[model samples]
Target: MTAPRTLLDKLWAAHEILRREDGVSLLWVDRHLVHEGSHHGFAKLAARGLKVAEPDLTFAVVDHYAPTRDRAHITDPQIARMIDTLRTNAKAQGLRIYDLTDPEQGIVHVIGPEQGLTLPGLLVNCGDSHTSTHGAFGALAFGIGATEVAHVLATQTVWQRKPRAMRITVEGTLAPGVSAKDIALGWIAALGTDGAQGHAVEYAGSAIRGLSMEGRMTLCNLSIEGGARFGMIAPDQTTFEYLENRPNAPKGAAWEQACADWAALTSDPDATFEREVKFDARDIAPTVTWGTSPEQALPITARIPDPDTVTPAKADAARAALDYMGLTAGQALEGTPIDQVFIGSCTNGRIEDLRAAAAVLKGRKARVPGLISPGSAQVKAQAEAEGLDQIFTQAGLEWAASGCSMCVGMNGDLVGEGMRCASSTNRNFRGRQGRGARTHLMSPAMVAAAAVTGALTDVRPLMNGRAA
Candidate 1:
């Protein structure tokens, strides 16, 4: 008789090549994703005179510094150099790359699942922290540092200290206008940033299962913001349907068998986790971040929290955040002025997110300047085909190419200093968008609502009489 094992246990055991005396495990790398920032790893490999151990298993992308505008005429020499470096490295290493010229090029996290490179029961690694986005497909995915990246490039294996397993179950259905982004914010707000530290969180129950593949990706993408090692959900019909016919997914008989195997990847009924948390979906609201951290979020109808109201350990940080954000405590969060809006990122830049924003922006006009970049070129084309791009432009927003854009502040699509932006991107950390910039993280629809009202208006009111 075997004991009930969690999804993490199964994934860890399957990929683990060996366990060291120090409790460190050597894991077989299934997919290694690299971007422009990975130049450090490539440089390390070059200095060591080693080639990528398994070029076919590695993939390079030009994202971090990818220009959202005028790719053919990138003026920033530094940005151009970074993008070219990844291209040269990938070509020299014989690894596949999705460069700016490639139609499939997009954010690493977005394209991985878009092309079906992410799958159930696989371990994925990337130099970017948002690598957990792939875990939405039930893969064990997490970010790696420059040294770890080099190690993987040299051996196609990585050393890791196994993280404990935690399960967060959200029961019941979400109210209209509420979304996965809200659920993520709600949990982080309740638990604070370090709530799931050193734990690989598996989201379960009705609400999680009901989320679309894109929603699941958004939810998992923000796991790191809450100090989670990674986040995952059991692959089911929705997962299989999303992966069906993807470019890199298994074909025909292989696909059928793959789904069957993935179906068994769920945690057993009797599986026990190191820690468990539960949330009633109905209690979550359309949420937004007021402070610098993702956990400093609250319901749309709430007021900015007073520093004194925060825990003694966090009160000073809360005060500092308020000062940096130029916000006052005890003020209503709704109707707070915003200088601009951004509606894209790996966190909320998929086709579905665009559709949600478009549904809100349609037949309306934005009161402030904004940029809307698609997650990938494929998503860009899909948005154009569906006239979502037209809706954005008609609503007074710039329709830009696919890339990290303002979300990362590396590609020059940045928010002005002291500017307040309602963004769909994950992470509201000070200077995340740009130095001296103030960011309020929310869902795409909520960003669209802010763009229209030029304030932090609850999307629910704007969504009234509109399809959710």
Candidate 2:
């Protein structure tokens, strides 16, 4: 008889239709989500005359290239064509599509949880790298490439190999000025760029347990940055409470059954993981990205690293990033000038993120160019009705419509070459924003502080009267 199994193992066992020794297993996919950018796979399917196997299990959305400003018709001809193509493709394939005009429409990652489409113990897949965001619900979620996307659509299953597990535990309590974003940045910083390669990470400990649902989303959103295929938190009371009364959440008798099952989804005390790392949460400060990679970061209180002091293996990349960012060694990050500030993306584009930014920008004006795009239309409407958009615009930040704006270059929005931007979006790769455009990833509140000061300013000081 086997002892209690990890959540991943339990899900895999339940979904395993057939297992071939050393061969691909015929597993079932519970949910398959795709967005407008997934047209690449649709086109491939069309060329092959293959149809989507199960429309019930597949959901498509429009976000990546959807027009933000003019919703009437996508203003950009190329983008408009893409939007029309998705509608046509999904319709012809008989798949459920949450289109631009759908009340449920939003960034794929944001829309899934909002509608309660993402559930615990499910196997989820999407064409975008950020699909791992669903793992916040304790689902075995991760991204699939264009080919894999087509295959999943053609048959309700994806062939995949299991990955090793890494348990990351953060004990102690977070300081007042710190946030989930800071913890995420700190993990990436300590892990470097490829620390969790070929591994799925499970986060535990008191600090993670204390994080809100949105914070858990933020933590899992950057799992890819930590070099993990995905990250998850075992379903706890907080997770159960958040999903309890949600729109499509299981109800009445179903709810009780779900809670019972979810209660059994945690890792056993004797469960073994491939590797484990622990951190003292109190030791982490507000974190910020300085160089190209997400791992290339330092605390807001620390100075930029000198190339000479960097490890030999990392020196070349560090030098290259420094040259591209035009930063001098040992310079304090506090006073670096910023040309723009962006507060949006799947990472931190929800209502909570907006409120945090607005708190710092209230009654203040931005000295640098700035923009804030909520993750979805519902969030946008709520922010406006609550007058949060007014606070941002009054403070000189542009209030834009929803879509994945500026985070991915597929949209026309972008930063000018060589400009430095304090952004809330994830991924600070060299060409992430645009060629030669420098990115400094920080919390939404900190990004607002940078906008107000027109530099990489610290929010801890600005929250009061001083500027750190």
Candidate 3:
């Protein structure tokens, strides 16, 4: 019998476009999700008198720099022009678009699976780093540069080398106060910034199976932070269950057939891996990043690492992060002051995240500045109807319309120089939130705790040192 292979290998093999005699493999893209960033790619193609060769497989959205605070006319000429350009380009190419005005419009990664546009065995690409979020739905997704975006748009294909597989088997159950965010942070912390370098991670084992779709998305969203191209979980009954009755999902018989196909997509039991890691979920704490990189994280209950103990290279990274963040080693991660608390992004802006934050802020008030933006207009309305907006406002948080807000500084929401922010967004890289901004990435509830407490305290204490 032939040796077993992972779902990634199986899908890539199935979608193989052609093999280069030199050993590189070409991959057929099943979905090409684009954003305002890739409009330039379309322009480049049009400049050469080329059209989107596969309009049916391409999708465009305008969320990255879309204004969320006012939703009024985009006064910034550059942003307005960019938005118009995308609309024109999508129309010109006959590609489907979830326009800003469309009820379905949202972060590309969020709307894609919500609309059943992302599916198992598909090779997906976007021009944004978090495209890995789609992998939670059992697809092989990765981000591409503008040049590569143009190539994919021109041919519905692109060259890709196979990534080595790493099976990260998380066992047992997560302890109290632990979340997928914590798990992701824990792994990144353990592996440093490059633990999963040049590899595709398959997060498996009992603990992962128990995570909700939102949790899975959170885990996969930060795969790149761990130096991984992406991470994935096979589409199982849980996946089918999430999509079976969605408005855009296949109906009845079609869904059954789709489920059957997805069932065949998992890695075989005997599959081999280039590397494997194991972790006990209980060992993970409510983690928070102390410095610029996600890997510069420590459990909230733990103290920051001493720079002296690390190797020279690690010491340099630690020093750079500290200098940029203005922090000293060996300090408690829990009591640092926060200037702002932001809860909204493709990573944690979903309705579930809102509920989690609302739960923590129910009768509490944020002593510091706070903001909450839902992932989509639909989520906004749902949250408003539930009076979640009231909870946030009563807790001293600004209830705003949905868009990338604070998740990316392009929307004009920024954390000023020397101001530390407790955020639920993914990246905490240098100047990620804004120029000279210091961001400590955590979960929604954790952000709420920071908002109320005005300090980097362990959220486990609020939830009674347990996962809520």
Q: Which candidate is the best by lDDT?
A: 1
lDDT over C-alpha atoms for residue 233 of model 2: 83
Q: Candidate 3 versus the native: TM-score?
A: 0.97
Model 2 Cα RMSD, 1 decimal: 2.0
Weakest lDDT window of 10 consecutive positions for candidate 2: 459-468
Q: How do the residues 1-468 of candidate 1 rate in per-residue lDDT, one tens digit apiece?
A: 899999998899999999999999999999999999999999999999999999989999878898988899999999988988888999999989998989999999999999989999899999988998999999999999999999999999999999999999999999989999999999999998999999999999999999999999999999998899789998999999999999999999999899888988989899999999999999999999999999999999999999998789999999999999999999999999999999889999999999999989999999999999999999999999999999999999999998999998999999989999999999898999999999999999999999999999999888888876
| TM-score of every candidate relative to the true structure | 0.99, 0.96, 0.97
lDDT of 2 at 304: 92
Which regions in candidate 1 have their CA more than 4 angstroms from the true location? none
Q: lDDT for model 2, please.
A: 0.85
lDDT of each: 0.94, 0.85, 0.85
- Residue-level error in angstroms, candidate 1, position 251: 0.6
Kindly list the per-residue Cα lDDT of model 3 for residues 116-235, writing each as its tens digit: 888877888999888888898888999889989989989899898888999888998987667888989999989877999999988998899998888888888888889888789888
lDDT string for model 2 (78-146, tens) is 988888888898898787887877776778888788777788888889998778788888888889899
The 10 consecutive residues of candidate 1 with the worst lDDT sum are 459-468
Rank ordering of all candidates by lDDT, starting from the highest: 1, 3, 2
